[model samples]
Target: MNEELNARLLELLARIEPLLPPEQAPIDWSRDVAAIWQRHALGGRLTAVAPRDGVRVEELVGIDHQKQALLDNTRAFLRGRPANHALLWGARGTGKSSLIRALLNDLGDEGLRLIQVDRHDLVGLPTLVQSLRGSDYRFVVYCDDLSFEGSDDAYKALKSVLDGTLTGPPDNVLLYATSNRRHLLPERMADNSDTRIEGGEIHHGDAVEEKISLSDRFGLWLSFYPFDQSTYLAACRHWVAHLGGRFDTDAEAAARRFALERGVRSGRAAWQFAISWVGRQ
Candidate 1:
């Protein structure tokens, strides 16, 4: 009777085992250059992934100042020098995310590895950073399209990882995030209703301070703007030429029409136009 009860318990355990999150596969830091942070019911784990290919830094056009600033900071970090966490904030479809990918491609040979984490999974950031401590390879903890709604509690986790912690992030790890919102939090007119002046000095209310504090932790801030017509056209021409398509007068006219129809010009738009234009030829 005891043996039969044990057998029944074993059978029930087997039935439920497969529903649990799979064990995280061990990552070979020396072999893999990129990974993604995956959250699960148990906690979170890093999954090795292939780094994106064919995105050269040279191919990124129309944001020279932003590119150079980030590159310099990254280079400093790679050399074990002081470097600040970077926040790339600006217009949609600009080269914010592309620059990070390109940096990985350009510097991966020099012991740079990328670990991408989603904003939703950021609650695990401190644990993740602690695990990567004392590693030989430098890590870029990348969060793409990061932003928080007013009610989101996830930003607290991020803030803790950035500066609120006692020990702070490891020397080998730095966070690089991209967002369309400069502050990474939604702002409303009501939030500013508490603003007041005293002793000829202006003071912000608790709500305003809360929003600004998150972005302030990132020491390096780079802003990207919408590309002008000339810059947009130049990018279109560059991509077309790179893709083995001729950007002649006719192609230029067509590109202009494409941009006009879209109502916004950006590096992404230019790349799309190039793909469509080159595919026909």
Candidate 2:
């Protein structure tokens, strides 16, 4: 009876053992600890250093300086050097976010990772840092379409992550963000400033200035403006030529006509028009 009872107890314990928290290295005072842990869900997110196993971020168009600036930064990080947090700001659909991914794909090492933290997840910034603090891989915490508006408290968490008084972000980590608004707000208006004075609200102006300062925290700021008439036409020509005689007419005229009809001249608009033209065949 005693032997039978011991076997049953061992079987029960084995079933529950796998559910317990993983064992850590023997906690030793002499050992310098970095709290970095592998992100189990990284492959699922399509954000983190993408499992280069097979991910495709669309190729970015037209922004030459923007592309090189980003590539340079990522290269430095991969080489284990200091790199600045970046803010990619400007007109909508300028491929700010796409460029970030492409740069990572082009330069990131197995040791470096891209962890996308959504705007809604801003409150968890510190938690992310704590989790990543000890890891050897460099991290690019990416935020897309990030901005603060209408009493949003998430910015407070972000400000801390950007340049916290308690502790700077780990050398192994950096941040990259994309925003449509230069100030990331609604014309720099304040909740109470509108009621106080119309011509000049001193307090509101200061508040706007503060919001702008958050963007300034970025060491590298890359602005993507609307593409020009020639650039737009060039993009069309590039696409058409790349396709090798897809269109019979000269691309310059059609590109101009497309931009005029769309009422916008941007890299994204250029690509959209090009894709549409290609599909016509």
In terms of lDDT, the best-performing candidate is 1
| TM-score for each predicted model, relative to the true structure | 0.92, 0.71
Poorly placed runs, candidate 2 (over 4 Å) = 1-59, 189-206, 241-250
The candidate scoring highest on TM-score is 1
- Model 1, 44-77: lDDT tens digits are 8899999777687877999999989998999999
Worst 10 residues of 1 by lDDT: 195-204
Question: How does model 2 score by TM-score?
Answer: 0.71
Task: Tell me how far the alpha carbon of residue 208 in candidate 1 is from the true structure, in angstroms, after superposition.
Answer: 2.3
lDDT per residue for candidate 2 within 73-178, as digits (tens), equals 8778867788889999998867787787665556543454666777776776777776668766677878888888847888877788889657788888888889
Candidate 2 whole-model C-alpha lDDT, 0 to 1? 0.69
lDDT of 2 at 272: 75
